[model samples]
Target: MHFAQRIQALEKNVFADMDRAKSQAISKGKKIIDLSLGSSDLPADPEAIATISASLEDPSTYGYLLHHGTLNFRETVGQWYSNRFGVEVDPQREVLTLIGSQEGTAHLPLALLDPGDFALLLDPGYPSHAGGVYLAGGQIYPMPLLAENDFLPVFEDIPSQVLGQAKLMVLSYPHNPTTATASLSFFQEAVNFCRNHGLVLVHDFPYVDIVFEGMTQPPSILQADTQKSLSIEFFTLSKSYNMGGFRIGYAIGNAEIIQALRQVKAVVDFNQYQGILNGAIAALTGEQTTVKKTLARFQSRRDAFIKALNNIGWQVTPPQATMYVWAKLPQTWENKSVEFSTELVAATGVAVSPGAGFGKQGEGYVRFALVHDPHVLELAVEKIAQFLATRT
Candidate 1:
């Protein structure tokens, strides 16, 4: 049997492989302490949930929801953006509802790339970013994110040749896996770079509200691209409102790009259940206590986890934002991240994401998601210490 070459690019998946290792550990009677995936374990906002429940009773919401049906939700998103970032948003022209930010990130490439067009992507970016490019038959020019540079890509390093072929550039911060945040100056630099090069700029901003105390809140790309020129930003309720299961998010920015993405979306599928959008609207417009509480809880977990790792002699800096700790593996295991993660999980039932799984530059490190409570995170660190003991 034959399959599309695009599917070939997805044949090797790090998270899927980790899931199998976890299942094997469970089969051997190991109680799994998973720190691999970044899914939030926090509860969704009660107001959001209540709104969804109310929507379910309305028979009008049961049928197919076209673009017009999402007007209310999009208008709410536009207001939210204006209030939070002081940037005016024309919801009707710029905001497009998404099943999740992943969906928009994955599908937008279809709108932007013709076969073999180039997309400038971060080397250790979220996997779906690459997957989307591959599916669109687009070539990828990986921009290395080095620790020496605070895990930010250097625009000057991109070869003139790749820049000539590049159609779009994707950025996300507070970044996943690395948990690195970017400043407004950095975004301004990015906006200027993309505009000069005639490339569309896409920012995956799922962690927009996940900053730790004392840390500067990460800037929106739109904040830098004040006129929404050449840029589009994707936001998900998954990280901010704990609505991963609800599959709700939206894209806001350049009107032309948003419309093109909407065309691609129309061909793929209609909108998700109308009730989810109602819930998202509530989460956006309602009191933000849940958002604050969630950020504080993740910050507590970050402190506890970093302290516990340090207590075990594995010095790791606490992340400023996002719900992950990116740690360089000890010297002996630096080049063997996949092996280390696989064997450690099997032996200790403590699962983590290998840095190499993210990309070539990700080698020599591992990422731990702070999805568990502080106590459980500390316990996981204890198990990690025991596992490291045998390696020494």
Candidate 2:
């Protein structure tokens, strides 16, 4: 069987290899503490669940959901965004309901790029962002995001030549893997850079509500001045509403980009079943106190994990948002994220994502997902300490 040249460029993933190691460890009867994927263990809000349950008896929801079928969900998302961020979103023209934001993130490149066009991506950004560019036959010029830069890419470092050839720049605030939040000022710079280069700006905003207490909330890239001119931002219900399994998300910003992504969707999938869309609408437009409670729970877990690690003599800063700790590996395991993750699981039954799986620049870290209870997190860290102590 023949495979495309584009598909061949990607190596079999390091994260998948870690997952396999985890399975083997679990099979060995090692009690597994999965800190790998960012899947939420929390329950969906009762109102949203009730909406879905009630819709279960509605036969109309079983049919293929076309573009316009998501109207209520889109309007709810638009209002939610406007209320939360002061970004005006027109449900009619500037909104697209996604099966999940990953779908939007992975497909938008196809709509935006001509073959061989470049995409300026964050190094160690969400892995799906790169996959999207590859599937679009676009070249990825990863802008290295380093610690000194607060894990935000510096537009100045992107080669003028690459920018000249690029069709889009993908960003995520309250970012995945690194769990770093971006400032509005940083987003304004990105917006200006994309405008000057004639590149589309795409922001994946899954963790927008997972922010910690005391830190100012992160801004949407669409909050930048050119957002109305040249940007589209994707939002997911997975993180905030604990609706990951429902696979509901939305894209909002400029009308043109939203239209293009919607058109791309028209070719690929019917919108998700209408019942899920209804449920998403309930999650978005209904009372949202669950959003704050979920944030508080994760914040508590983040504090517990960070304090436990620090008490055990491993210093990792508690992230301001996102359900992850982008921990730099200890000196002994520096530059071997995969090895460290694998060994930690093998010896301690604690699963974590090797940061290198996110990108080459992610080599010195491991991402710890805080999906488990604080007590479980405390135990995970204890096991990690034991594993570290046993290492030479």
Candidate 3:
């Protein structure tokens, strides 16, 4: 049997490899403390769940949901954006519902890139960004996000030739894996760079509300591109509202870009269940107390995990936002992230993501998702300490 070359590009999935190692550990009677993925281990707001439950009672929601059926959700998203960021959003022309932010990030490249075009992506970005470019037969120009630069890409470093062919620039704040947040001024610089290069700026902003205390709330791209010129941002209810399983999110940005993405969406599949949209609407419109509680809980977990890691002699900076801790590998594990992660999990049953899985620059680090309770996270770190001791 034969498969498309595009599928071939996806064969080196880090998560998949980690899953196999986890299974092997489990088979060996190791109790796994998995933290390889960022899926939130929290519950959706009761109001949102109640709204969906109510919608299930209505038979009309069982039918196929087209783009128009998502209007109310889009309007809710637009209003949510306006209320949160002080930026006006037009639901009719500038908002498009997505399965999740991943869907938008992965599919937008198809709408923007032709074969051999270039996409400027963060070196250690969420995998879907590169997958989307590969699926579209587009070239990827990885913009290295260095620690010295606060994990943000340097727009000036992109070569002239790659910039000429680049049609899209993908960014994320309170970014996945890295857990680094970007400021509005940084976003302003990105908007200007994209505008100058005639590139569509795509910001995957799933961790919008997971910001820890004392950190300035990450800005929406639209806040920088106030006129809705060259930017589109994807927001998800997954991280903020603990609605990961709901597959609900939206894109808000330039009208033309939104429409182009909508066209791609149309060809791929109809929208998700209308009930899910209703739940999303409820999540956005209801009292945001759930959001606050979620933030507080994650912050507690972050503090506990960071303290535990540091106690184990694995010093790592406390992330300002997001439910993740991106830690550099110890000297012994440097440049061997995949081997380190695999061996660590196999030996200790504490699974984590190898930084190399994210990209080349990610080679000497590992990402830990704060998906467990403080006690569980500390236990995982204790196991890690024992494992590291063996190497010494």
Candidate 4:
């Protein structure tokens, strides 16, 4: 039996490779300290959990949830967006419930792209962004995010030929892997570029509340495209609200794009369980104290972990947002991110994501997720120090 050609691009996953390595290390009797994935270790807010628990006893929520059934959740999302970003949204037309933001990101391409059309993607971006394009049978033109330019793509560098065939461009910030935050000004420029080029702009905004150092909340793409022209943004409860396991999120933007994605979703699957959306509503409207506490906890871990790395002579710039520390590899391991990560995990039982797994530009770097407690993060660095000493 033969698999479809689309499966070809999905076959070489770096995370899967790392997972096997981690399993081998555990089999060798090493206790693993996993910093490879960004799934938060924090618990969901009690309010959200209680809301879901209550729904389980309500027989009304046990039926299939169609698009119309999600109206209340959509309205809550609209209110949350308005209060947070000061941008008005029509929940009836511009908002769509998603299983998670990843579902929207992965499925939107089917609605936007034709086979062989191009998508302008950030190199070293989240893996699912490229996977979506691949699944849609589209081409990807990676816009390199260089350190010299603050890890934001330079629009002027996108070749005109590539731009001609490109139908969509995806951006995320605070970005994954690199943990780079984009400014409102940068988003304004991106909106202008997309407007001029007739390309749809998609912003994956999973880390909107993960900032540090008293910085303002990251601006939404709608903040720049006030008219919702040629733009859509995806948001998830996973990162900000510690609802990763709940798999609830939403998409908001141009009514047409929202409808298009909704059509694609109709063919894919119905909405997530109504109970989950009810719990998500509780999360969005409930006290934000859990959000604040989660941020403070991650900031503490970031400081402790970065300090430990510097103490071990592996200096790295602390990230401004997201739960990751994107560190350039030491000189000897610069070009061997995958090898370094595999060997380090095998040797020290500390797992981290290899940068190259994200994209070619991600080579020569590694990403450490600050998902563990500060004490565990410090211990992981201590083991890493020993590994580096032996390698050097």
Candidate 5:
């Protein structure tokens, strides 16, 4: 059997590796407390589910779904973006529905790059972001993020030669793994940098609604390029509506980028069945109170978990946004992210995502997903405390 060379550049997946170990532990009678993946433990909005259920009886929606059939979903996306960000959008040209934002991220590369063009990506970025680039045969120039910079990549650091070959600059905030949020001003600066370098700006906005109190609402890349002439931002119902399993999402921004992504998508798969689109439209156009309640739940979990970890002697800062708590590993475990994750899960059954899985620059930190309830989180912390106490 033969496989593509791209398959060799990446391993099966580090998160899956942790899952197998966790499963093995559970099989041996360990009480597994999984925090490895970020799939929401919350239920999908009843309204959205109800909307889908009602649509199923209509045989009209059972046919092949194409772009024309998804117009209403696109219009809802445009209105949602306009209301959320105050940026007027033309749904006809600037919106495209995706099976999930992952579909867009993974497919955009094919439209933007001709094997071997460079993509400037976040160093501790979502794994699939890098995988998408590699699958498209593009070279990656990682923009290493650091704590001192508030986890924002330094625009001045990219080399001049690399800029010319770079066709896209991918960024996400409230970011994954690091839980960092970028200000609109920072986004404006990024927009100017990308414009000056002639690069397409792609923003993965899955965590747009996962922000917490006192922090400003993170801006969409579209807001930075208000004319919708140079950038596109992707949104998913997965994080906000607890609809990860539904796999519905959309892209709103530059007409060119939308068209390019649409071209790639059209060749791959048809638009999602209309019932799912109807549910997503309901998610966007219906009452938004659910978002605030969801935020409150995650915030409570974040506070209790951080406080518990601190009391147990792990000095990690509270994250401002996203569902992750990026904690610097203890001195004993620093730089040994995978080992620490494996040993901790094996010993305590409290599974965490290893930072090394993100990138080499992420070696000293471990990411904890705030998915469990406050009390369960506290229990996980206590188990972690016991493991640390005897971890010599």
Candidate 6:
């Protein structure tokens, strides 16, 4: 009946709690409009799917895939990174395939942090970041991402003592649950800071391509550390290529970090299906039209959803990147994010993520994923308006 202490830390996921609430609502015959998770509703690119379909016929791909089997995918990732960011990567040494960037982010702590070491994490960061550090028995020093600072962590504010014990600093942009993008200048500053502090810089870059409004693409962390001296970045096909279910992503940066993560991965499990890698290769190297189309679709949804919320008097800034709208709660619901989210879903059958689910600093906001089509998003907003009317 006894379980490892680590299991206790993993127990309190707000997303899972919301899922149970949603299931109860659905059971009562309430039609559900879920904007909770960021899982894309878009289909994977046909070419990518076709490539995987073709691979399924190859019996050789059915066997367990080892590290060497991932070389082609790694090379593709390297070339993709080079083409996208002007960073030359040694595929053999620098690239490691992952079962989604989540796998890389979650498994990384084991390689970087020993027991009692500190990880400087952004408050309201992606939940898995904290889970990873906890699993590794690492302490977390949350760096609050304040609105005044554009939701980016102010590194200098980190206590000198905490900084001294911190082994790694985790950053993501456009950040999850916040939809804030960091500038190249900020990344440059982070690089210098981490270099000076002798801490590894980890950037979880799932939203790299989900940008909008003719904005410049988000810069790679490697763009700030061209030598990859103290940095590693994780990228996922889930956001850009609509391959979330396929679970294909990669880690690129410090060769030492990649090797350490790979060693951890080897001990845990072998690589994902080789066919999925083929699909990922097709996604990265194939015509990027699907990627562009995906961006356009999300942009339209973002515009429509923001307009609808504004029409209902819930003013929120349109996000420049990522498929989410992070809105501060109204006065009545400001400090009751979990209750507001649960009650809203119960009353209107519209499910969204309570910001408190992400971290303590997320207390007065909610994150709405723009995964549905514009029409459905507008409908969800209409329902939200009705729910708010009742509250008033």
Q: Write the per-residue lDDT of candidate 3 for residues 1-392, one digit (tens) a residue.
A: 88888888999998899999999999999999999988888888899999999999999999999988888888888888888999998999999999998999999999999999999999898999999999999999999988999999999999999999999999998887888889899999999998998999999999889898888888999989999989999988998899999898889999999999999999998989999999888888898888999999999999999999999889999999989999999999889999999999999999999999999989999999999989999999999999999987
lDDT of 6 at 39: 95
Q: Model 6 TM-score? A: 0.99
Question: On a 0 to 1 TM-score scale, where does candidate 5 land against the true structure?
Answer: 0.98
TM-score to true structure, per model: 0.99, 0.97, 0.99, 0.99, 0.98, 0.99
Native-vs-model 5 lDDT?
Answer: 0.90
lDDT of 5 by residue, 158-269 (tens): 9999997999999999999999999999999999999899899999999999999998889999888997667988889999999998999988888888998888888889
Worst 10 residues of 3 by lDDT: 172-181
Across 1-392, the per-residue lDDT of candidate 2 in tens digits comes to 88778886565675678789999998888888999989999999778889989999999888888887778887887888788888777899998889899999999998999899999898898888998888899999988989998998888888888877889988998888898898898888888888888988888899988888898988887679534899888888999899999898888888988888888988888888888888888888878888988998999999999999999889998899999999998999989888898888988899999989998889999999999999999999999988888895
> Model 3 segments beyond 4 Å from truth?
none
Would you list the clashing residue pairs of candidate 6? Answer: none
Winner by lDDT between candidate 5 and candidate 4? 4
lDDT of 6 by residue, 1-392 (tens): 88999878899897898999999899888999999999999989888999999999999999999999999999999999999999999999999999999999999999999999999998898989999999999999999988998999988898989888899999999999899999999999999999999999999999998999778999999999999999999999998999999999999999999999999999998999999999999989998988999999999999999999999989999999999999999998988999999999899999999999999999999999998998999999999988988897
Better of 2 and 5 by TM-score: 5
Could you list the CA RMSD of all candidates, in the order they appear? Answer: 0.8, 1.3, 0.8, 0.7, 1.0, 0.8
* Cα RMSD for predicted model 4: 0.7
Q: Candidate 2: misplaced stretches above 4 Å?
A: none
Task: Point to the candidate with the largest lDDT.
Answer: 4
Q: Which stretches of candidate 5 lie over 4 Å from their true place?
A: none
Candidate 4 regions exceeding 4 Å error are none
Error of 6 at 202 (Å): 0.3
